[model samples]
Target: MGGEGENTAVDLTAGDPADVENDNDRIITEEFKIWKKNTPFLYDIVMSHSLEWPSLTVQWLPDVSSLPDKDYETHKLILGTHTEQNEQNYLMIATVNLPKEDTEIDARKYDDERDEVGGFGGVDNKIEISVKLNHEGEVNRARYMPQNPFVIATKGPHADVCVFDVSRHPSVPANNTVRPEHRCTGHTKEGFGLAWNPHKEGGLLSGSEDMVVCYWDLKEAGKTVAATRQWKGHTAIVSDVAWHCSKPTLFGSVGDDKQLLIWDLDEAKDAPVFAVPNAHEREINCLAFAPHSEFLLATGSNDRTVALWDMRNLSQKLHSLEGHRGDVFQVQWCPLDETVLASCSSDRRVHVWDMARIGEEQDEEDREDGPPELLFIHGGHTARVEDFSWNPNMERTIASVSMDNVLQVWQVADNVFNEGNEDEEEPADDDLE
Candidate 1:
């Protein structure tokens, strides 16, 4: 696959070892500058805030705060930390400052009066902790109950999910500690899979490395919550789980077993109602159902590919998206765009895609930019993108957190998705499996 000398040479191994040694620092600085200069061309607005430590997950609070005198809007974030053994880990709430909804939006910039000499590296970003709770262990994952945003749940300390009414504590510093009011315990090992049923109040689902999924009813239970039911069909660790947006009894999961399964609580708990074995060439890391189109599903995997599948036909995938060179960690359908979705990966990139643009004609530049459906590629983070979510309250907005402890909140350029394109029909739903 190597090309000629003009751009050829696969790597640095072609010359004398010492002379060929790559200067990573030099390369990184150069790359950051180039990307920052191009950001304004790609983003409508962007904010890059760094945290005290990297969070394994990030979620937007349902509400946004607007102050009369300020030029920016304030948004609260739900986050969890991963720290060294000797350090204290926490479930945290942080507030970010953003330019008030679209009066004026710009791109990444640089100033000599910065931390790094070439610092567009989170320089203009501002964020601060609003509240922090002492977690029993590193937070594996965190989610706010959909129906009631004030109620939050965190997974950690070996298969336990702690439920907290976050409103109980005032907006205090990280030191003024509060504890979870209830805890759900059952699985034998730790997991990153945790979700709340959107249509059902107090309904929670958690899966673990123990190859089991537990359904917890947190409403009537006391301090220590127990699973009302458990499912045991997965042969390996369950990587992620999701509850259907409109169906209270419907849910889905993907796992290291290379399987995608659909579950209905109204049916037998011991077996999945439908499953697609080998839905991916490698184990699936995460799956999300399209919120607007109930029949469509998106999945990311160790295969470095993102697959779109129609639940009605599991025998083959509708599209196999190829670009990421590393394992994809999270794949989420945007709340505001029915045909749009985003995926984060171990390759240190966050890619936004649009299904409606698939197979479209492209110019030379567009042809070189991966796939036509790959709307945008955010290569801002210096480390693996751990997690990301679309802003529930804004258009084309996304918040992504990374292993480098950076949290970027950016909105795609309106023209990126809307230019010259009329609204197309929502993906056909005649085939809801």
Candidate 2:
């Protein structure tokens, strides 16, 4: 009896393991099951709620209005880029933060009335710049459209980018922001590409679908206006342009003629410093430079391949990445990771590759062993993927835009295999009892 007495345990409650199982089953049924199946992660994240937010195009703008010196929290503005039958561009903007604790109705009510309370949405003043396309096929001029809170980007503050709406202005106030006051006369044809000079303030470049690249110097003279520089090149529609982050006057453009044109804005007549001919097998859609690797440049093309070129030895191709079946749309290198590059294609697939190992000295025989490893294939979109952007501040976050008119933000895990499976519940260790 004495030995057996030591084995005794207390059953202080009416509930047994069966009851525990039943309680958990009810709990999961009522609370966890729906969320576990639909939500992206066990915990809350920006992408946890749903994937219906279509439109791969998004920009992360930090709240610089506060403190002026210290960077505030970043917010993502997601929207679609499409021209409808009414000739109106419709877009939805969603502010991305952590999933909120507020109820759906409460959230809706808050958003609807946010501006009235002088909250984040209350700021009615947005910097507006207008781009005018002329018969000569150039962004003839860009001007600031006057409105309250509309400040011209001159010496200190600068507008991030200049956007064009194919659709004319609507009668509604909400729609008024979408309309251009004066018909921008610059590009002879519709400009396909618009980029702000990362180096020079108010300096912008626009590429025409008609095979011409124009530079615009935006200045303040009563009107928000942009003037074109004499610099012009590319025999075909310039599909993409990339500016050296540090070099203000230096930028490169890729055209349908399968050429890469590099320029120095200061030396307008000197021609491109380096012109890579036949850089792609087909039309090039986009180009990007490694954030750290100045000598490295990446281009995506209609030939379904992305080629990485080493500027030091441009005479030969560095690495030709192949896998995309359809035309490669956009390629972006991770701002921080030298080895990783992300590419999206008309095939509706986003592929990431690690090419740091593909060093210049690697022998052809060794390379025959294999190319860089394919990291992941994201396949959620149903239409041609148009553009994908990487957040400079966030790790493993990428935003992609597609012809489907949806913007998606994907948080790629470094270890895709380690993702938690919320479907199956693990039983507690019996011995612990």
Among all windows of ten consecutive residues in candidate 1, which has the lowest summed lDDT?
A: 1-10
Pairs in clash, predicted candidate 1: none
- Candidate 2 on 1-433: residue-level lDDT in tens? 0000011223434778888767644643433233222222211122322223233344433221233332223344424324433333333334443212221211111122221111222233211112211111111112221221121111101122233332342222343243332222345555445556755654666566656666665533223344456345688877777776667788888988889877888884848888998988899878887777778888999999999888878777788988676898788888767788889997666777778444444457434433534555555444577667666555666666666545545545323312224653322223111
lDDT by residue (1-433, candidate 1, tens digit) is: 0000011113554677665545434444555555565554556666677678889999999889876866777788899888877678888888876666644543434232421111222324456787887777788899998878888998886667889887886555346344788888888899988989988889999988998889998877799987888988789999999988777899888899999988998885479988999989898999898999878888999999999988788778999888786899999999988888999998778888889889988898557557788877776676789999888888888889999888877776665556554662221223111
- Indicate the residue-level lDDT of 103 in model 2: 13
Give the TM-score of each candidate. Answer: 0.87, 0.63
Q: Highest lDDT, which number?
A: 1
Clashes of 1: 0
Local lDDT at 399 for model 1: 87
Candidate 2, position 75, lDDT: 46
Give the candidate number with the greatest TM-score: 1
Model 1 regions lying over 4 Å from their true place: 1-28, 106-125, 173-178, 363-365, 421-433
